[model samples]
Target: MSHPKIANTDHDVIDVIRARWSPRAFDLSRPVSHDVQKQLFEAARWAPSSANEQPWQFIVADRFTSADGFAAMLAALNEGNQSWAQYAPVLVLAAARIEMEKSGRPNQHAWYDTGQAVSMLTIQATSMGLGLRQMAGFDRDKAQIGCRLEPPFEPVVIMALGYPGAPDALPNEKHRAGETQPRARRPIADFVRYV
Candidate 1:
């Protein structure tokens, strides 16, 4: 089962959109299959991007497949995230290719395109009854070193992916509280301006 953190929206949204919310607690016992992971990546593969650059890269490590790789990825997270993210079965580092492949010029939309890809991935995961938490709290230098990422590709977000776990499984009360809290967002009118 996925996290019960559904959005309380004034207007109706599709089930997947309403159901999508990041969760910190992940089921350590449940391992995502390679086939399912492939589907997620496939969804990301189709995201639209400027000039179709599709400038996103990902580094994935699963606890069940490679313990050393998982440990290395875990080390790249900040201490606060490591305390909880360690329980996730799958950890992914998303990156962006900062330069246009052909012209060797900087691609200004690289990060935005990467975010679009991740959003597609997130929706796919939610539809498949999985939950993921995208985190920006990581040591970029450490992640680059651990993944051996070179120029043109830089880390964007580190994500913890797996089945949702019980809130009590969280490492501390603070995180547990955050997990159980109602999801909130600004009203549509506040963020949207219509001419």
Candidate 2:
């Protein structure tokens, strides 16, 4: 069964931001189309970057669309992550350039900029009624080889995307429960400090 709607805390926030959460169980029967895929990346392409240096690249593989693409990427994931991520119809390896192409110097904020891009992508995906789970459980070295990434493009997170599947399909009961669990956030007092 599809998970029941998950509501946000009483605090006010954008509907999309509140609704966005990672889902491990994907309805692999529903394939993500190329057009929708383009839209997701378009959203990422517009995210802000330091000095306008967009340093992120996404290597996407769709099991439902491309032959052997998804299987190849899956091989790069850690054994544990492969268990659940295999169910997702789409897999993406996100990488960030460590140096700016224009300046030819190290870009200290490249990773941070890439995160901003991924955030935009997630919001766009959520708006389109799709779900994604981002995992850092892959070996970076192996991902570099699997993704065929060259120097300067360091792998970061691997994201799985597709339509949400029945929570009951998940092996762990906790994962099923998490699909409906009330989202939590740290209090501002816990992380924010007054100067």
Point to the candidate with the largest TM-score.
Answer: 1
- 94-181 per-residue lDDT for model 1 (tens digits): 9999999988899999999999999999999999999999999999999999888999899999999999988898878899998878
Which parts of model 1 have CA positions greater than 4 angstroms off? Answer: 1-4
Task: Return the number of clashes found in candidate 1.
Answer: 0
Candidate 2 lDDT by residue in tens digits, 1-195: 423455445578888877788988899789999999999999999999999999999999898777577887898898777878888889998899999999899999999999999999999999999999998898888788878899889998999999888888877777778777766777767987989
Clashing pairs in 2: none
What stretches of model 2 exceed 4 Å from their correct place? 1-7
Q: Candidate 1, residue 80: CA error in Å?
A: 1.1
Q: How close is candidate 2 to the true structure, as a TM-score?
A: 0.93
Give per-residue lDDT, candidate 2, residue 145. Answer: 86
> Candidate 1 has which clashing residue pairs, if any?
none
